[model samples]
Target: MKKLLILVFLTLPMIAFAQTKPYLSIADAERITAAAEAKAKAEGWNVVIAILDDGGHLISLKRMDGVQIGSIDVAQAKAKSAVYFKRSTKIFEDVMKGEGGSRIATLPNAVGVEGGLPIFKDGIIVGSIGISGVTSAQDGIIAEAGVKGY
Candidate 1:
């Protein structure tokens, strides 16, 4: 039992540090926002876009012309969900539609939508992007464009 406990303590930090995901730099966040905005403009879809670090901290946010004000909050919430959960908001959205989906609704700052995506580098999630204002599908497309930059 002593040896097993020692082994467990030794491995705990290794397991916790296994995720070597890098933090997003301000420049990187700016680039992501620009890419997303370009995509939205190209598609003529006015939208709000948000970028968040791995810890769910907002890095940048942009509200395009003609976008609804409410989209600002929604976009941030989506980004928060993606970064905190290390997955796309689409997953939560799909799960929420199932028999037990309502349980997820109780989670704080959980926005189950299709416009959030985790930004990965070298198979590690570094950050996330969220887009709103247009339809969920359109917002996802724009967010994908942003994630491609990071």
Candidate 2:
């Protein structure tokens, strides 16, 4: 019984530690944003960026010069939708649009809109990226630049 208690105490910390998840720090987000923003600025596209955790929670977000105000919420929603859905939001829109797309778009937490992409690291999905303020295609390109860090 004493040995069992000792083993439990020794192993508890390890178990607890494993339960803690690794998330991208703010600095990491800034680096991604800066890199992506620079690329977008080169093309003269104002963009709003969003980063979300694996659990689809917003971690950090930014809007560059001249981006629209509404782009902020839409960008975050697109990112969260991507993280939770685990695929490009564009895919859902493409799959569900027309015949069933509109219906699927109505699903809860389904932002089948656009400008959402999963952030992968070492083959695991660590988070998601969303961009807005420009065309959805342009937003995609900007987001792609940020994902290079992964």
Candidate 3:
């Protein structure tokens, strides 16, 4: 019995650490994209939406008809920026308006845009969403709607 107890204690930490961390599944990415797309359509905005997993990996991308081709890369960059910075891309945008903020432009993969948002589940970041093609503020609004859906 004492040996069994010792063995249990030895394995306890492994069991605790094995708990699954929240992750953004493909379905979740699709749902987020759908929500953002709906918002863009309702606003009559042609846009591109990008979703990235917590590790800043692309999960999904959707481009509405008539949106500029450039927005596709822009959307992905914004999502990556959100994941890399662990915050909204809008924060970088705001910082860019301040003195010394130009340095933000030098940060690799850091997009100082207003349309990237981090998606959180149970207070843990699961992924991020980014939108492009419309005005920065409008893209932000759409992104917000998407996060709300999640």
Candidate that would win on lDDT? 3
Cα-lDDT of candidate 2: 0.82
- Write one digit per residue (lDDT tens) for candidate 1, span 29-135: 99999999999989889999999887888889889988989999999988988988888898888999999899989998778889999898777777899999999
Between candidates 2 and 3, the TM-score winner: 3
* Model 2 weakest 10-residue run by lDDT: 19-28
Count steric clashes of candidate 1. 0
Q: What's the C-alpha lDDT at position 63 in model 2?
A: 84
Model 3 CA deviation exceeding 4 Å by range: 1-19
What is the per-residue lDDT of model 2 for residues 25-65, given as tens digits with 9 covering 90 to 100? 67777777887788788999998999887888878888887
Name the regions of candidate 1 deviating beyond 4 angstroms: 1-21
Q: How many Å off is the CA of 79 in candidate 1?
A: 0.1
TM-score of each: 0.82, 0.83, 0.87
lDDT for 25 in candidate 2 is: 64
Better of 1 and 2 by lDDT: 1
Whichever of 1 and 3 has more lDDT, that candidate is 3
